[model samples]
Target chain A: MNKINILDKVKSNVTNFFQPKGVFDKNFVKKPLIMYLIFGLLLLAIPFLQEQGYIQFYTMGVFGMIIIYTIVALGLNLLLGYSGLISLGTAGFIGFGAYGLPFFSNLLGLNFTGALIVTLLLSALIGALIGLFSLKVEGVYLAIATLFVGEIFLEIFRNVEWFTNGFSGVKFHYPHVILLFFQLRITVTSFILLVLSALIVIALGYIGFKKYKNKQKSKIEKKENRITKIKSRLLSIFKIALIILGLMLVLQIVLGEPLLTFVQSGNSITTTGFRGYLKLEEFDRNQTFRFISLILIASMFIIYNIVNSRTGRALMAMSRSEHAAQSMGISLMKYRLVAFITATVFATLAGTLYVSWFTSAYPDSWTLGFSLILIAVVVVGGYKSIFGMFLGALIIHGIPTFYLKEAFADINGLPFIFTGVLIIVVILFYPYGAIYLRHDIKRLYRYLKSKIIKFIHLIKQRIQKSNDSEVNEDE
Target chain B: MNKNTILEVKNLSMYFGGLKAVDDLSFEVFEKEIVGLIGPNGAGKTTVFNCITQFYKEDKGEIWFKNKDDEEINLNDIKVTKVINHGLVRTFQNIELVPDLSIIDNILIGAHNQFKSGILEHILTLPRARREEKELREKAHHVLEFLKLHYIKDMYVAGQPYGVLKKIEIARALMANPKMIILDEPAAGLNDVETDELAGLIRHIRDEFDITVILVEHDMGFVMDVCDRICAISFGKFLAMDTAEEIIKNKAVQEAYLGGDDFE
Candidate 1:
């Protein structure tokens, strides 16, 4: 009896651990939780292993890139998916920020800390202006207007020598902190720890979502209510755990010191007389990459809230039919402005990130051709889902360059060509992107399961009736 | 009628490239009164509603709307957004609930102006903004209850029955908390039972809320049973304006109906 009681208590506690609250109430389950936990542990081991020379340094770099792209993808999802504003100039916004942030850092000597703030504010201002103008023209015409903005910015970056460091590009130095009295030295291990901490900070966001879904499910008697509540809870907790695990795996790689082993590879031109590759001595001080990632995460959360708010609903109504929205006492122009402004804010922050990471501003980076890639990420990920964009970024930008670099290394621009092809496939086969695909697939599975259950219930009812009739005959 | 006058129109006119849609139309709607605007197709009944809502720019018109605070606003001077702010909102002939959004979400959108917290507040989700959001949701639920649409509150607007969609639209319009609601056609596509329910609902809306109601309906029975006064129009011109009994006896209105019946 004691053993049975202990087992029951353990089972209940385990179930409770997976239960989601608030928004995540609908999806808590066992399978998803296990998958996320395993995945997160694997990832968290990466950097430390790289440091110990067990994993490649490029893998960690790829992870960083994925984080950044995920942020951009989330932003685009709000503009295109939730609010129905199609923008093709996403890359331009991100690239502008990326290039702009680094350039500001170089010229002002404010280091990454000050430059990050300045870069975000400037991007927001520029984004607001662009949004204002785009609202005047809509549909294909608005796309053209944004296209022109990207093209114009690219031209300026290329031609303007002083602002963009010309075609050859500019270089930047990182900042260092030392104890005032003790003169204690700061190390690269500490920097990697900071990055790891950021990943954990980001993963905690799943907790918030889980809580929200659970709260909603508790209020309604929807048919799929209980199942959905379980699923949401499980998904969020699983995602969080998986993220932690993934970071730990990455840390293991970093501990092996993968970047330090680059000298052993065929790229030993550094020994002869080449400086193309980044030196570890200076790269450690540069926090632009991390700051960019942080900004992307912040902006995405804000955009998501705006898309679900009253203003977002009004924008969608306006998008459907201007005449009807007007009848409902919604000002069409006001709603249009809201969509434009929201999208532009995302674009500007993305641009600043680009400037900061590359330590240079280049016109070609913000071209329409480049910006279309960002749009493709949103499309491939699922335009309406922020989570989908994160997945899309991983598929389009992360995997191709990181895992498959060797296959296409000899071919010029093959990665981009592959991304373009993927975009086409996603648009045709999965118009909503990867996130919607997952949602639809899950919904279908649930529907099938419920049908089976109902059919079984009917059979049982018939059997019970027959048995009752037999009992009556015997009597 | 002096104290009763809530919305007064003088020589209201609207033209689309010399084709006068509303030609020198004039009318008055009183506080807490249910007024019906009935006419044949293209008789400019909808155009008057459009003009009042400022959906279309009028060629000429003077509209004075008296508020609860006893301030009279020149409706012509007020922009479309301000129309709602001034406590005047309208529904469409076709249900105009945001189709992709949930029924509850549609109602919340109608209450956009009521929640004055800006983008920053919403993004940060400040205490006051959250409080306002909670209150707004409660108000939306109340509106749904008033219209008997609370059951389908969580359902998406797509594929709903016409009568239900129509009620949902009314619920959404009420979210604006307007002093008066202009329903373009309350019972156009409803069955007998639904129409009866709609009539009861409209009366509840007026009596319980003490709000002015302007209905543009073709169903004469519904209009006669519910309206405090009736206005009949023909060829963008007003033929009769009086009590339901007076409208029924008016020779001008009878002739106008006869004239349109042959065309139909």
Candidate 2:
């Protein structure tokens, strides 16, 4: 009973961790909690892992790329998974952002936020145009039409050098409007742990004081226990002092940057953080990666909420049976347009963020192959699942770009072949995507557990029988 | 009895290239009445249903339905989606609930138009969005309870018993707060016991929901047992409109069904 209670408490806390209370709805965080925790821990520990030489430093840049693609895939899933519409023009829409941002900010003299807004609007307009031409047709036609749209954008990128700068590529520089990144001598893991404990301590202190004030105060008043009162006051002061100390340490770590002087003069203090030497540029790149990870979480939060709402239901219904959805008052034209625009906007947003990290846009990057790969990412992850898209992006892009590239450096184009084969096999076996791997793993574990229990029972019985025989022999 | 015309169909006609599916048909349904549209296989019964619901654009016709706001509006003038705004909703000949969605989620979809929150607000999960979602969820639960299918609320609509799927469709229609609902082949694949249970369920919907019911079904026994009136059409032409007993006795309806009244 006590164990069950502890488990229940843990489950509730995990669920409440993403509740976004006062901001999000009560049940907004009804996602796979274990996946969230795993991702959360990985993201926080990644910088530290690299700093500690457990991971390659360049992997940060690769993770950023995977995150950008994942955002785009999540948007596409809204179209493909729920609405049953396919848009192969994801790369083209994203190019508009990469090119449009530079054009707006540099050439058009717009602020960064203004440029982003303009980019979103421009993408939406093009998205609507493509949707208008193709959406009237049935399923396969939409795919063919969007493929053409993608080709058209590529041509525009090549010819319209005035906007995209053609094969030369367009450069962008973001001044970091969010103010999120900071370099510290302290490892990220230790810093995060400190912050978490500090928060828990403060929360506990507040709760205990509230309880004492409400119930214990009256008891103390009746007893007239001056000693108890003074002790309680002293405890409150101590709590306040502890909070101040935690804050001071946090400030020192973030700002002052003197953590037992493990800097090693110029060594990265740890080797895996940079290539041979520590540079501010490398730190910025790592921060960009971290910033994009924050973006991944936000996008997931938004998509998860929307996918569980009325609009999502309508889209799913429309995909399954148009006549039923129509009779139920879900407008096909409205919802289809919404899905198309939403998908393109997300692609564009990913592109803009891509520019922030890469600081440049190349026409070669947003080609037909990239668009196909984006589709593969969404499918291989999970079609209608938000969490699956992230996992999909990681496996589809992260593995090939980070690990496979090194593992098969001797063979040219080997990683691409590996990715293609993996996608085919995964789709063949798990048509629902690799997200259902959890279910399979859980089943396997349970089977093993039961078998182990049975084996133990048999062994116990054998030992008991031997003991009985030995006792009879002694008699 | 005061006959309140909740829906009035006038000179409704539809065509399929050269084939006249529904040549010209007319019917009227009173509020809180259970009406059945029945005929032979090629009698254009479903075509008339499609026309009234605006699933197919009629060559010529007027479909005036009394909305929840107590206003008679022409469904022909209204778009297909806006027909539900006038508190007019429908089911399909085959069960059309989304297979992947849970039974309760499938039903909550009928309340799509009831959602006033914007997509952005929903994405953010704002308080208004939360409030609206909570309200609609409660409504869905209440509807599930009414149909006594609350136990299977979390189960997927796919692989459900045929009888349960049929009830789920009706339950979804109820979630719309509709003034009138049209069910197509509500008893298409039910056993005798299920058919009997469906009749009771239909009666309960009519009495409890205080809405008119119009269904296209070939289950004559179920229709005759439940419907307040029966409208018979043969080859896109109206044959008869009366109570079940009168419709059965009418020679035209019998001729339309049994082919020149040659009874065994």
Candidate 3:
């Protein structure tokens, strides 16, 4: 009882320390803290839930779904938010990844790990080809062209049996990791995988926070110290690389038995079920299932990194004005292709994760409905805000699975009705998304401050003029 | 005088279906001379600049530029992208800088060719790309310092005045390290004092950089002050080309000006 209270108190204090100050406060919610705290809490809470037996069934399902959609959102953000390219073919790209996974993993005799990487590269190559057209046209034309491409991809997937095994779909199986005399099964259980990936998502969120804040600070400062600029950029990249390495190491350790014999019977132990054996009834034993979440998380990290880089800024510039971007001598096609390719890579990998988890792949797995949900997430979450998109994925994809599906089903049009309501509410009330509402409120406060400054300036000017008039009269 | 000419236009014409905007225009700027292109409103003064810059494809005739290593190249045959490589840079009549990009970034865009760093280097954030980026930034800083625009190095083009933006455009054009610069109405929006400052800047750029400057201006006062030689054109035909003093006294030049009737 005492231990639980102490833990609760520590959590509360940590939250208080990082929580944003009042909207009116000038130094409210430093980005780094906000980013770390939000994701950190989510990570901590997951393991805690597993201890209480309250984190089964849909927890893994919902988390897995969120990871998938988050990847999709990351890709779409590159298109709509960064590269100024509007795409309606997200479902098609995701379907490509899903369908491609089976061919590489089963038919080609490639392991699950090999198949995932191959799927990502293939999707990126194809996406770059399709995204090439964005250079020639823009607005409705580019949108329609991409939409057509998506439709064509779907048609190909549905008709082609050899590659995708037709409309029925193909099941996935794990391959053993060969290491000298010892054989290691690379299959990952759901609970351990989710926890490990949740930790990674948290770490990535931290890295993203550091990057975004550093960028914002540099922009505001203008006259940045040159050494600091070089240092910060290098440090930011180094930190990202370090975090990725750490996540990979953790995945490797957790995948092998006897991974953790030291931990007490606490929340972490309950969540991982790692006691030198696969005897934990509460957690999954399939190594592939565990790895799917981790792999998806890793893909999410790549997406986040791309979104935070200089190329990302170029994407944003292109999105705002293609003519201006081109006039400045930026290769419009190169950046557009990069954005599309990056986005497709994320969706493809996410689809791979989805397939690996369920041991199945199909053309209809990521459909128009799935694409619409991703678009909704991007719009409602806030376009261009990567962490916000992840948060949005959690709320939109996670909540619907846990609580809102019944309410959605009870309605006549089901999920579409909720989506419609969400759009109207978002567009009308919070046009910038829930994350930006805090920013907007802060902007309003700044506006009020500027007005006050202007008023004070006017008064000072009046006083000075009056004093000057009196001096002239006296003279 | 025609023997050492750096650029020569011959019978250049442009038409938009029925409207002959530029008809049979011809002129030449001598090597190292600061030349002025002057004309009444709608007399295709800027159209000639656009033609030379290859921003417009002429319907007729040829535009020639004397290249380094002494080769005569046809400007009309060259694409806009190749024009910069030919050591000719142009500033627009209206400033067009990327608003979201910083002033230094705007200048660096003009210096795109300076860094021969490959796409792989840019992507991997390799040492060469990093060093090249820093070098380009330093060059931009130096140019901005020379122009006295160092204070706004980090500022975007939006929220700046028309005059400052114009200077930014000039600074950007200079980044290409052109052998010649074509400036369109550099003193248009500036007041008398600012115009005087600009006059000095024009002469300084020409003398210090050893680059030929070709200017188009409706501000006759400025044209008379800064131009080493002046050319007056009317109806896409060259009326006069001489020292500013001689062009001011030329009968054809006077007639083209007063012939408009609207001019006093």
Candidate 4:
């Protein structure tokens, strides 16, 4: 009787444990902010961990590239996912940025900041021009137009030997970091810290502001007295300011030295009748990883915020029905321009970063194949999800170039075959992208778990019966 | 034109190749009135609506609209997107709500023009943008409440019942705060009960929102019941424009619907 009681108790305990509580619950595991922070911290530790010989430099480099691709994917996601614009000229914008950076730095003799600003402006102008075409054409025709534009850009890069150096490409000295009257050479670590710290500040500020607003709204809902409302608002503002200040202090402690050094350095030089002193930074692979990761995080946050905004809603509506969207007072041309410009700027930034990382800009690299891969990344990642696109980039670009090249070195076309198969599988099973795979996996796990529990219960019943028989025999 | 006339179409004609989808069709929509465009299948009721809204540019004729600012503007001179800015908006015959977006988000799209903040403000989540967004959300909630669709505020439009989807579409149009709304076949797929509910809702929208409603519906019962004025058409030509009772008794409308002596 005791044995039977024990078996029942065990079975009930197992069932109780699996009854959708604690970690088993979806809400508990789906805290986006917590997950993001953890992921961010992990990314921060990667460079240090690599330096300690825990991870190889090659691996870090590949990871860094993956982070860059994630930024590109996020940018593309803004267009493809939110705006419903399928662009095949992503490579063209990237090439323009890549080539434009060198042009600005070498010919215009501008610093990194100036070069980036100029490149972005030029890319926006070009993007706007391309956006105009979207007004006239859409879907497959727009795709073709973008493709043609990309090819034109490639041709310009290849033929303009004076600027792009033709097939040979243009190689220029790294742009210096200039501040006030000081110039300091930048290391990869400092650059990473600089970018990451800025992103952290923006993200935290935005989130903090949002939380404060929600609190204030709730307070208003409670019908708090006006005086009390004012007092609480001031108090909340003070608290937020203090928190932001504290965060800044912490970042300063971590990254203050590099910034100080950058400001204090008095490295001077004169070039071609120009007298300007600037910091020259040597960017290494690890810094590349850190920088790209920073960009990825920042872009992800921005895109997330945008999608939740009115502009995002308009773009989504436009995608579903142009006629309906127009009826809603959405200016199709304006929103399309915004989406196109944003995508172009992001691609341009990625291109500029790529050139800096490799210390070379290649026309051949920015081809139709590159653009197609980006499209595949957005599609396979689940066109609507930012994080999904990140994974999509890793799968589509990172895996083929890093892992497959190493694993199947003898197999000339293995990467292509593998990517095709993977894309097909993802499309077939998770048409939404791998982001939705979590739900499917959870469902599968639940089914298997229930079956296992039943099997265990059946075994326990058998054991209890056997024990009872033995007791009966002894008696 | 009457002092309250919000829209006037003069000899509006649209042609697809040699086929004239809408030819020499003219009508006027007055303030706070429900006008029905009734026609048989292939009579170009939708085409006429499209021409009025400038979805398809008429090869001939003028669309004159009295905008919210009290300016009489030629709608034909402007693009389709600008028509809504003039306080004129429309709903599709087939419901066109963004399937993936929540009902609130879908309605929020209609508030795009009302947003005071620009792209930069939205991207940075500036105070003004947040304030605008909050106000829009409140307005959307109010609309949903008014339409009795607050239950489905968070629900996606995908696979929703035809009645609910039609209501959502109208809800979206209402969110635009338009002076006039053009609903194409608002009760197309609804049953008798649903159609009656829709007719009541359409009247409520016109009265409560203080907007002119132009609807193209095939259901004679629905049209007669809801419409203040009925415009009957056949083969892209205006048959008659009169009160619902007068339209029901019109000989040309009867012939158009029941066939002429040639058929007998």
Candidate 5:
């Protein structure tokens, strides 16, 4: 009885210590904005830590690759997850961006931004062309069509000497910021600060919007005087102004010095015609890591918001039942085009980032196997989830390239073997991917918690009975 | 050209190779009326619905619908997706709700055409898109409440009971705010009690929403209990069209149901 009592006391103390604070506890973590902020800070700090010798450069590079692939996976998720359209031609679109970036920058004498825009537009056009052909086919046929398209792109890249530099590939300088007559290099610290600040601003905007929505809901319930209405409106305006001011302050902190230096150092405003006053400058490994991380974070938020909106619902409906979606007046062609274009654009963006990081575009880099791996990422990550895609990318791309490659140095094909095994396991047990693991874990915890509580109750009852017997014996 | 007629199907015909699925069939449905298209299995009832909705291109037909704006639009020429824009929507025989989605989300998909915002607005979650979403959500909730499905609004459609799925299909059709709703075999797999409940719900929906209903059902009792008028067909050929009482008394309909053994 004494042992049981002691055990019960210990358990109660542990439970009390872990009890939620009702607000800003487990519930706060449940909020996506908080999770984004936490992840954003961690991603921003990793590269800096690596440069300071706290982490390896190779590990940082792998992290950078993971960020790049996450953006691609998110874009693919918009297609495969919501729209239910499978494209094995993701690598082809990536190639378009990779090659297009350097081709425009080096040959056409366009700046980085111009090259990026042109590449994105070109990818969209190609995606639409593919989507047009896809309209006539579905399921396995569509998959096969995309596979061939991917091969065709590879062939073009390998054979086109004048445009893609043939199999030799095209090498170019990294992207840079050129203002007026002077070039401004974005240092690693400033880049990290910029990304972290942007993420913070987005998180702040999301929280502010949520608070405003809640306030409006409460105000709707209460009848207000004219003065109160005016006061509330003024308060909302002030809040908006405050958010804008916060954004400007963060931006200034990151880019203020660079802009000041460029302005003071430059007097010549040369006419560059179509290319503008921008130039491409070489960036070190850490700077590239920061840039890719920034792009990944921004893309994650955008894709997350889109998937939660009305457009997402329609796309999902179309994916589930084309007949029903059509009955609801969701134009199959329009939504399909939208999905294809968005996905291709995202792949192109990732490719552009990749070329900027590596300072080279190679036809052999993007292969059929690479495209299949991307699809695997979406499948193992959990369909229709932005964060799941990130997790999937880490597990599939990050773990293999960084962790497993080092751990299993003798095994030449260990990553491929691991990916195949993981895919099979995910398909068999958790077909919904790693995201569904969260639900299963929660259910398990609930079951265990109930059992523990029941056991505690039984122990308490037994102890009470022993006490009663002892009292009776004494009497 | 009748002012009361909401849908006028003129010489509709659909064929597959040598087989005539719908053989020059014509029918008229009036405004705010419950009409039933009754036939035996494989009697081309669903084909007619498909042709009217332009899911299958009719080899020859003219389906003119008087929209909410009182404009007579030819549905045959318009695309399948545009059919709902004229205030005409349909439910499937197999219950085509998005299986993985919550009941409310499935209904919101039904309100897709009603959204005024474009892709940009939806992606950005702009004010217009947010307002439209809230309005549609409230509308979906109201429809669920009316159908007494408010409790299961958050539940996914997968593995749901047949009766609930049928009701959800009706609820989805209602979300379009249609002037007319076409239900294909709504009571196909439902029990007697559920069929009776469906009959009552159909009447309630028609009365409350002030909309017309056209159901293709095999259950004779359900058809008699709910429909004001009945159109009977057999072997892709029209048999009879009259009030429910007259349809029950018609010899041709009885022959179509009892004597039709050639249907495949």
Candidate 6:
């Protein structure tokens, strides 16, 4: 009984000392904000690491690409991971952002801000339209429809010089900015975008208003006048804002007045005004990597917040069982559209970031192959994990391009073979994703810790035995 | 029983291809009543539950329900998700809780409709979202506490024992603050002791929440023990709607269960 008590006391002390919770045990790597910050910090440090001769300079560029794609994958996680909606039109819409920006800012003389706005609007509109068309079909059929959409975008990018500048690609120089805040370049082009967004938002608002109207009008038949009074005022104010926005857009396009573009530097490398003061001398890949790193981190924060909230629960519920979700008052159609559109929006933003780095848009880059690699990233990373998505991006994207190619420099075909085999092995072993490797890692850690403790106990016993013999010799 | 009808299913029918799963079935449930829907295996009891919950689309007839808002609305007109908005919630027969989520998180799903925060608010974890989350979390905890499930709230629904899983499903339905709850086989996999406790628990829930319950079960003793009224059906046709004693004494119910006096 005394021996057992001693052992129990020792065990309790050991457990108390090693307990991780509240001491980073709540989870260090799994903690949301810290993980994103670390991701951004590591990405930022890559350029410095390159300068220190630890990594190659080309690594900065690849890391930049990873950052951009990480942004896209984060959004795709919502659709693929949360709602379980498989969409293949990602490359198409991202290309839209990449091409749309240059098309508007370079060809049409819009500033950076205007170009981004137009690009975002165009991507959202097209995505929603496609979501509306394709989302009616469920499961693999939805994937097939989106596949068609992707192929169609690729064909359009190949054929239409107006959008993608054809095979030669669209090239334009982006002005160097201190923080994107200081020299926030505003650019032009694409009335269809501004009009489309205004129309869609107004249409949605109107529909909601009418639905509310019907509900209230039905609920309290006698209080019709009050309902009309409150609803009309809100709708009227909303419509007035829309009208004003419409008029301003018309003036900016038709009259050619610099209404919004504070810069108004029409396709000129040199700026002359307050905008000139905001411009930095140059922007290399290193700086771009850091900037895009911050961008990726910010998006990760947003996605994390979204995935932990009520909306996220609804999405998971829908993904797991549509019947239960529907019975719980989760409208499948609305959340699906939201997930799809949010995905496309993020893809477009990533495209915008990609163009910001490369200063060019190429049809060759935004292909079906790139889209599949994205899916592979989410799959390998663990669909439900945000941090795992980042790791997945690095592994899937970095292996084939950087490490594998470099290691097997002489063997031209080996990298592809190795990457394929590695992916298969990882998937086979960790069916959920590489993120699940943590479980095994923790188990190994515990086993090793116990082994070390046992060794210590043996050593202590040996020392005690030696002391006892020395005491006997002295006696 | 409350004199006012809470749910009126008039001539409800559902068909799958050429099969008439429910052919012109009708029933009524009153307020604050523990009602049992008993039928022989494949008598369309589950089909009726599905149709009432709007999980299955009906081919014919009207399902009028007095919602939590005290508004009598047709269940057919609204979306499936909207049924819960009207304060009607149901538990699945097969325990449909997402295994990935914790017990508390699973329960929060039923409160999905009560959340009024916008998408942006949710994405940002703004004050409104935070407030709603805190409030609902407390509510879920309260639900867990009521069901004696608080100790295991953090555990994932996966790998939980069958009895615990059933209790968790019930807790999830209760999170909606439902005016009416439809339970599909609440005692299917449960042992006798659990079933007996479940009978008391059901009565307690009806009394405490002041809500009506409609459960589909095959356990005749359980139904007889628990139900205020037992509605029997055979081949999608209404057999009898009466108290347990009357249902037991009824000849049609006897014939339906035991293959009539000829078998004897």
Which candidate number maximizes DockQ?
5
What shift in Å separates residue A281 of candidate 6 from its native position after superposition? Answer: 6.0
Tell me the tens digit of each residue's lDDT in model 4 across B32-55: 888999888899988888887887
Q: What's the ranking of the predictions by TM-score, best on top?
A: 2, 5, 6, 4, 1, 3
Model 6 C-alpha lDDT per residue in residues A381-453, reported as the tens digit of each score: 8988887787788878877898889899998989999989999999999888899888999999999999999
In candidate 2 chain A, what residue range of length 10 has the lowest lDDT sum?
A274-283
- The estimated TM-scores of all candidates read 0.74, 0.83, 0.68, 0.81, 0.83, 0.82
* The TM-score obtained by chain A of candidate 4 when compared with the true chain A: 0.74
Docking class for candidate 3: incorrect
Considering only chain B, report the TM-score of each candidate against the true chain B.
0.95, 0.96, 0.93, 0.95, 0.95, 0.96
Question: Can you give the lDDT of residue B179 in candidate 3?
Answer: 81
lDDT of 3 by residue, A293-344 (tens): 4444454455554543346545655665543344334566678788878778
Go through the candidates in order and give each one's DockQ. 0.31, 0.42, 0.13, 0.54, 0.59, 0.38
Of models 2 and 3, which has the larger DockQ? 2
Off by over 4 Å in 2: A1-38, A180-283, B1-3, B262-264
| TM-score, cand. 4 | 0.81
For model 6, the TM-score of its B chain against the native B chain is 0.96
lDDT of each: 0.70, 0.81, 0.70, 0.79, 0.81, 0.81
lDDT of 4 at A128: 92
lDDT of 1 at A270: 30
lDDT of 2 by residue, B1-264 (tens): 124899999898899999989977888899999999998998898888888889898999788887888877888888888888788888888888999999999999999998999997787566568778867877787789889998889999889989999999999999988899898899999999999999999999889879899998988899999999999998899999999989878988878798876433
Q: What is residue B110's positional error in candidate 5, in angstroms?
A: 0.9
- First chain TM-score for all predictions: 0.59, 0.74, 0.62, 0.74, 0.72, 0.72
Error of 1 at B91 (Å): 0.8
**Comparison by DockQ, 1 against 4, better one:** 4
TM-score for chain B in model 5: 0.95
Q: After superposing candidate 1, which stretches have Cα over 4 Å from the reference?
A: A1-55, A173-293, A324-335, A358-361, A402-421, A440-475, B260-264
Candidate 4, residue A27: Cα displacement in angstroms equals 5.3
Colliding pairs, model 5: none
Q: In candidate 6, what are the lDDT values of residues B191-244, reduced to their tens digit?
A: 999999999999999999998999999787898898999898988888899999
Residue A220, candidate 4: Cα error in Å is: 8.2
Query: Could you tell me the fnat of model 6?
Result: 0.76
